[model samples]
Target: MMRATTAAAILLLATVAKAEDSLIEIVTREVKGCMDSEHLGSIGGLRSYNDPNSAEQKCFLGCMLKKFKALDADGQYSAEGLKTTIQHCPRMKSHPDIQKAALQVADECNGKVTGCSDYCSCAPLAAKCLHEGMKNKSFQTIFIALDEALDKMQS
Candidate 1:
């Protein structure tokens, strides 16, 4: 009876892990498709907020934000959508402070970029504003969490 219960628990855990893996895979595929469509190379270019100032990089960031529903059709930022995207990652959801920081950044960026004519122009400004608005420690913490999540996924 104990052996059967142990097996069941293990199986349940595996199923949950698989579901999480699938979610990540789906998001990755969608983001990759966005990159391909935008003719963007090396997502690494977006590691720094200032680095995405180029036209192509700006378009790529716009593509990603749109794909995640963080930027609406009218070139406006959605704080709720951005927060939802961050919370979608289990590791990110574990850090409530990160979510709050993200929302604050989104709100500030939204104010800066709301009047832009298109996402390409809006996204870069938003990125720059977000970078400026976020606390250094919060920014580092978010980046570290992202890096750790990526490492775990890769491994």
Candidate 2:
């Protein structure tokens, strides 16, 4: 009975390991597809973010962008990228250019952000907002309009 129990445990462990491996494979393939897609722009920009000394970091970030289509030229940043940025980058933001790029990418995933209104669903509007903000334009006009429309919310 003890031997039988041991064999059962081994089988269970092997099955769990196989499941994990399959998940990794699926994720990697998805990322590869996104990276190779023509819509996705040059991944050269993102390549700089990964630590040169850490192969794992490099692979992880690359896989992330590729899987989610965040590097797409036409602003195809996947829901994953936006969710990640909104959750993580708010405090630990990096280079200005990267921040801007991240915002732009997040704009592409506007639909996924919880509580983000439908009015801001379109990418063009979000792109315009990000572009103008990045350009150092005083958002006075927009701020005033929003303040007036939603006075308490602005506070």
Candidate 3:
């Protein structure tokens, strides 16, 4: 019985490690696609996130979405996809789409998103913007609070 339990534990560990690795790969690929399609090597607009004024963060996200939509018309936020993603990510919260994409991964594969899917709205191209946006703490702070407010309103 001890040996069986040990083997099962090892198997679970291996599975978890593999899942993490797969999620990383998926994120990397998606981000790369976003960067390539959008021609956005780096965003100069996101530098003010630490300045205490959270407005820039919101503006940056909005601008990024427009640019992304222009680059990949197929990736446009459908009314349904936007609603679902918003429901999952709650837009008032900073990077709602980014949060949605991340949560989409969590939802689709037990916290491991290996590829884009119906739930995960961030396509190969849009994921890059999300990854970049998340690095700004100011944005996160405002976004999180906003998410709480929005969630409450919705509820």
Candidate 4:
């Protein structure tokens, strides 16, 4: 009975892992579509999160936030939406620290970009806040994954 239970646990884990991979793939495809639709120049040309973003880059970031439902209809940062997004995204879900940092960033940036009716302006501010807040945290891998995803889309 113990051996059977162990085998079932392992199988369950494998299934969950596969599901997470599928979720990531679906999100990546959606993001790639957004990039193509937005005519984002080149992922390589994007400035660092701390640097000032060009209009196109800002719009692209906005598109991403919208696709992920991190921003509300009015282009405001939605903490609840962000939490839901992180919970569903395997990459962010697996990293509790990242999840915490993201929420904190949302809290800090809340209402700070008020009156920005478009994501192009609001999303960049929120992203910069997150980038700065997580600079000392162990979140580099997430950014690296994003870079890799964008690179793959380029090809």
> Model 2 shows how many backbone clashes?
3
Off by over 4 Å in 2: 1-35, 39-84, 90-125, 137-155
What is the per-residue lDDT of model 1 for residues 38-150, given as tens digits with 9 covering 90 to 100? 88765663542444746777787677557555678865766666655655645444555555665666666565666677878777666556556654423442222222323
Instruction: Give all candidates' CA lDDT scores.
Output: 0.53, 0.32, 0.31, 0.55
Top-lDDT structure, candidate number: 4
- Please give the distance, in angstroms, between residue 87's alpha carbon in candidate 4 and its true position after superposition: 2.7
> Order the candidates by TM-score, highest first — what do you get?
4, 1, 3, 2
Query: TM-score per candidate, in order?
Result: 0.63, 0.22, 0.25, 0.67
Clashing pairs in 4: none
* Residue pairs with backbone overlap in model 1: none
lDDT of 2 at 125: 36
Candidate 3 clashes between residue pairs 3 or more apart in a chain or in different chains: 34-125, 93-143, 94-143
Candidate 2 global lDDT: 0.32
Worst ten-residue run, lDDT, model 3? 4-13
| Residue 86 in model 4: lDDT | 54
Winner on lDDT (2 vs 3)? 2
- On TM-score, who's better, 2 or 3? 3
Model 4, poorest ten-residue lDDT window? 4-13
Runs in model 1 lying further than 4 Å from the true structure: 1-27, 41-44, 87-89, 141-155
lDDT of 4 by residue, 28-123 (tens): 565567678778756764532534357777777787666655578777877677656556654455555566665666566665656677888887
